[model samples]
Target: MHRDQPPLRARSAPELVPSLFLDLDQMLDEFTRLPIRARFRFDPDMPAVITVEFLAERGPSLVWLLGRELLRRGVTAMSGTGDVRMWPTLPGGRPASWLLLESEEVEALFEVPTAELAEWLDATYRVVSAEAEMDGLNWDGFLMELLGGPAAASE
Candidate 1:
């Protein structure tokens, strides 16, 4: 519910992705509660993340950079950067966060982007919303799936 809440744990990467998909619709509703607008633009050619520097070229605004990255990766990612006036030491160091969409529903499609593109988009919204509700919920597991998994942590 709240951003600080503990995350739901899943046994495997596959499980996690689908769960996020299921939560997408709910996530959209939660985002609307925020002061700023969080909209997803679908580009058939791109996945979700665009080049980060490309965003900087346009302007320093948060929205532009985020939107570009989302388009480039085809997955949802978010980060923050306070202007120098706010936190001089942390300029452009605002926390970076990302979420991967691996919906079982979407993956099951016979086509790359099935007619359920809208549903996948909605699932992306949910992944973002849930992450917003929990600050400590790192996207580690999701990232592992993208890049290969790492060795087990030493006890």
Candidate 2:
């Protein structure tokens, strides 16, 4: 077992949430029951970003790279702006979260289960703790390349 190989990294399990296809309408009364798959991932090296891939029955998948902290905070309260936004919602007496992705052409709303979101966040945090995120960044060499400094760049 002493082969001097790279250490095995823990990966956050991708969450497949069943979300209704809904448009950004004020009433929000109607929603197609057709479910879409949302794949979530947290790269340890890119600790600050949270990647989400929304897969639908038709058309191509949409990939979103958002702030991990923003998503975590959104779990409890409304967070984010512009292209992404999230907030807790209780529909049909069930606890869930609403994730809205907006673009100039179109927008989509997803009702994500709060429990599943919590679980996924927990797993991602376990894989790369908040404190370790700074250390995980490869900012040293890259910054040096940008600043033209010698070795040992981090403070």
Per-residue lDDT tens digits for candidate 1, residues 72-152, read: 233222222331001011224332222222333421101112123335545544444423433434455444444654432
Stretches of candidate 2 off by over 4 Å are 1-34, 140-155
TM-scores across all candidates? Answer: 0.20, 0.65
The lDDT per prediction is 0.29, 0.66
* Residue-level lDDT tens digits of model 2 in 37-132: 776767666677877777756899888888888778777899999898998875565567778888898777777766766777777778778777
Q: What number of clashing residue pairs does each candidate have, in the order they appear?
A: 13, 0
Highest TM-score: give the candidate number.
Answer: 2
In model 1, the Cα lDDT at residue 154 comes to: 16
Clashes of 2: 0
Clashing pairs in 2: none
By summed lDDT, the worst window of 10 consecutive residues in model 2 runs over 18-27
